[model samples]
Target: MSIERIEKRQGATLVAPALLWTLVFFVLPFLAMALMSLSHLEGRSVVSGPDLRNYAKIFTEPSLLKGIAVSLEITALVTVISVALAWPLAWIIATRIPVRWRRLALLLAVLPFWTSYVVRSYSWALVLGEKGVVMNALVGLGMLSEPVQIMATRSATVIGFVHFFVMLLTLTIYSNLIQLSPNYARAAEDLGASRWQVIRLVILPLTLPGVVTGAFLTFVLCIGDYITPQILGGNNELTLPQLIMLQLGRRGDYPMASALSLVLMLIVTLAYLACARWLKMERV
Candidate 1:
């Protein structure tokens, strides 16, 4: 074979495994879930018959719709908070921090991801639990007469998500920020613009692609997250993922669970597309 043919063959060989893995793990399961969403639960078994009953039930059931709304609200709130918090931190780390410290900061940002998701979530439970560290500190400071109930509230869920995802957002946006030339801001400053004006006019606009990317990722992950909401948000908060888990596990309603999963997937896909379109426009 010619050199070009051999290179092409090698490239295809390398891609084949990933393609196969995606098909087997993601695509196949998604297709199955789509089929299952159109099915009906007949006792313990999921009856494989084409039906819109599951979709209809999802809309008709107020609780399910409420769960979806809650999920979206939480996703939006967490995305906003995570991105807002991440931007300044990422900017500082990327532009202001010393070269030697940058690596350490990046490592610290990603270190939390090395721990188990459940363990990290339960750590939040400890920090925010009644008689937990935060509560004890607040009580000591006379912020409250009793330990605040942060463990099982919507606020707790949002906080936990922020804690869990802020690192990811920081790293993503920081990577983008690091690539940006400081000259843009410097030039803006040389033109008699103040620091705030430079950032508002130049830096923020340039970093928007990163901001959008981080927000989109954080939103998707937070929306799909079951553990954080389940652990941190007891009976008070019911996200769509938690509801789907309940249907699948507690209620043994596979069809309903599948339907809910499909709905969540659609919402996530739409959000991703919208983010992609926005990014494209920003790039243009």
Candidate 2:
């Protein structure tokens, strides 16, 4: 009845919708999936259970285990490569480009986001094909004696992921870079530091928050992505998401799929924790 109590009630009322939405949509469904993961498929029938067979199989079975490895490898490679490429690109745009053209440059950098994700993956498949542009150019330039196979391989998946994530990473790094004071760099230069030393020691270290944030996003997205790896990388290797789809589509194994999904979530959670810890350390 008091003003403070009334204001507290109003705050709760304002926050209720989002809290309810999360509880209903995310929490309930996650609980259902976790419960379903404990069940197992028995002779083509899902036996309701609170068992650990599916999780056991995931870690024990070599083929199933390989999917997790492949996903991790591809995700790590994509994150590292994107960060490597994006930093320089973001630096150039943030520092070198004219101030008037900066907005246009950012717009151009994110152009790939406008295209459909599936279409972009398929387009990469075409580009990496035997008779595709890359192959033709390489063959014409005598870079290779023949057109090599790139499509339907892990390399193709990494390439497709890197292409999209580079732009994403660029945006994050650029945002951080633009916020930095020019005086920081000028002070470092006045100390007789070389350009490379200024960047390597001063600028790069300051952007750790942005780099880690972008890399964490890249890891989550690249690991869980089904369409890109399916279309571009094919079944030569399977990521966790691709394997989850296979269980549902081909084998009708909901329990196993649910289990795999939990494993994926677990991996993402660990990544998030690691990032958080490091960021806290940075702040300290």
Q: For each candidate, give its TM-score against the true structure.
A: 0.91, 0.96
Model 2 lDDT per residue over 1-284, tens place = 99999999999999999999999999999999999999999989999998999999999999899999999988999999999999999999999999999999999999989999989998898899999999999999999999999999999999999999999999999999999999989999999999999999999999989999999999998888999999999888888999999999997999999999999999999999999999999999
lDDT scores in order:
0.88, 0.95
Candidate 2 local lDDT, residue 271: 98
Tens-digit lDDT track for model 1 on 89-203? 8888887889999999888877888989998888999899998999999999998898867789999999989987788989888888878887887899889999889878888
lDDT of 1: 0.88
Most TM-score-accurate candidate:
2
